[model samples]
Target: MKTYETLVAEALTVVPEILPWDLQSRLEQAPAPLLLDVREPEEYAAMHIPGSLHAPRGILEAAAQWGFEETLPELVRARDSEVVVICRSGRRSALAGRTLVEMGFKQVQSLKMGVRGWNDDGGALEDADGNEVDPELADEYFRARVRPEQMGP
Candidate 1:
């Protein structure tokens, strides 16, 4: 079996990594690529990129098969759509990007540094209700939950 490092290296070769600022700029452009969050439901609920679609890494491959009541986004169901996968710290989403590439997705990328980078770069996150998450609360959560070791230099 391939090691995590091996897998991530392979994914990095094929899937381009986009910084938070780059993604923010892209979103401002017309026809923005789909932002797909591969974090768990609770993580997504706590905070996520505005306009991102949630498909937890565990169920990402089968997301299309899930019922609409489960909140499966239509963009994930479409095979040919351009997608950027994101997780808490970019590791899971790198694997998810590899999965999408293996599944024959033509255009797939992983967000560099994940939501942490986005938050650090002053990007806004939305709550479950689609309201903008308070910056202080977001910072508190990040500091409390994210270890310094987790944030790679």
Candidate 2:
């Protein structure tokens, strides 16, 4: 029998090191994974992976929003659909992915280094108001708002 991680990794058809650039291609070829930004709303608004859905970790884990049926249709179309959770780093997303799995989401994965890594790798990011933002400006905003050291487990 496959371990959960093994199963998920295979289902997703990619691994963490393959950062943001391959994302567009992945979406084109396979079932587009539901790109979930699990950071705070403010942090997410400042900049995030393009085409991701906003489901902050707090909201996703909170009992109120789990398996929200209203979003199910969109979820289903994203490659038979899988939810890809992301945060500043891999930690929170890993936890979120685990929770989704428990909730019977058969396929889930965490973006290993979060959007921060994506930005560092020259990935395009959009602003809080859903406008295009210069990468440098987004970096500054994220640096100011995302206190990684202060984040809680």
- Per residue, candidate 1 scores C-alpha lDDT tens digits across 1-153 of 998888888879888899999998988887788888999899999999988888887777777444554446575455687789999878888889888888777788899989988998999999999899877788777774667999789
List residue ranges in candidate 2 displaced over 4 A. 1-18, 61-80, 144-153
User: lDDT by residue for model 2 over 37-110, one digit each (tens)?
Assistant: 77888878777777888776565644314356434344434333566777875656776676666556666777
* Model 1 vs truth, CA RMSD: 4.0
Clashing pairs in 1: none
Backbone clashes for every candidate come to 0, 2
lDDT of each: 0.84, 0.65
lDDT of 2 at 92: 65
